[model samples]
Target: MTYLEKWFDFNRRQKEIESLLEETIAQQSEQSLTLKEFYLLYYLDLAQEKSLRQIDLPDKLHLSPSAVSRMVARLEAKKLWST
Candidate 1:
């Protein structure tokens, strides 16, 4: 094969390995998240973490605060969070 062709193959392989490594890490990350946690983290930006308030969550989710509280409590009980 030509030198150019060999170089192309090496570059392509490096890209493939990089892509595979990225994909594996992404999946590991995704596996660590949950649907409810997505909502919590969404609210938690880079600014701060707040106690999952009872009022706003219902309005935000279109579900009752009682329901949201129960779900949040379950998550807390499961050791999903600290504060």
Candidate 2:
């Protein structure tokens, strides 16, 4: 196959992988979380490797602190997250 063909094939496979992984996460969580919500939870887990702080989520998620707070509150309301 030509280089461009190979690149296209790789991109196609990568997208398929991403779709499958996303579906898996949704099934595993069994929570009706938006993609952003799922990503926030993933980031929180990643933060545990160092230190987690309320202020850090804005930078990590590229959202305002208030936005993160709102999302957290929603998750808490669903009993997905706790203080």
Candidate 3:
């Protein structure tokens, strides 16, 4: 195969792998979450390596502190997160 052909093949396989992974995520139970829930979880994940406090999460997300608190409260009520 030519170099261009090999590059195309590699990119195609990478796309396929990415598709499969995305499909898996789409089929997950967690996918039931709303957009707000999804973004909240995503933010928490980004903060995972650091000392992320529940209070600071809202500022980082640029959401109102009360809004963030309410979100965390709801998630806690659902047992998805802990205080």
Against the unseen true structure, what C-alpha lDDT does each candidate score? 0.64, 0.82, 0.73
Q: Model 2, range 1-83, lDDT digits (tens) per residue?
A: 99999999999999898688778877887677766688788877787564567787898888899999999899999997776
C-alpha-based local distance difference test score of model 3 = 0.73
User: What TM-score, over all chains together, does every model reach?
Assistant: 0.44, 0.61, 0.51
Worst 10 residues of 3 by lDDT: 29-38
Q: Alpha carbon lDDT of residue 12, candidate 1?
A: 100
Error of 2 at 77 (Å): 0.8
- Please rank every candidate by TM-score, starting with the best: 2, 3, 1
Tens-digit lDDT track for model 1 on 1-83? Answer: 99999999999999897667656655866344444445554565433455555566677655677777776777677676555
Considering every candidate listed, which one attains the maximal lDDT? Answer: 2
Cα miss at 62, model 3 (Å)? 2.7
Q: What's the ranking of the predictions by lDDT, best on top? A: 2, 3, 1
Candidate 3 backbone collisions, by pair: none
The per-residue C-alpha lDDT of model 3 at residue 53 equals: 86
Model 2: how far residue 48 lies from native, Å: 2.9
Give candidate 2's TM-score: 0.61
In candidate 1 the C-alpha lDDT for residue 3 amounts to: 100
Q: Give per-candidate clash totals.
A: 0, 0, 0
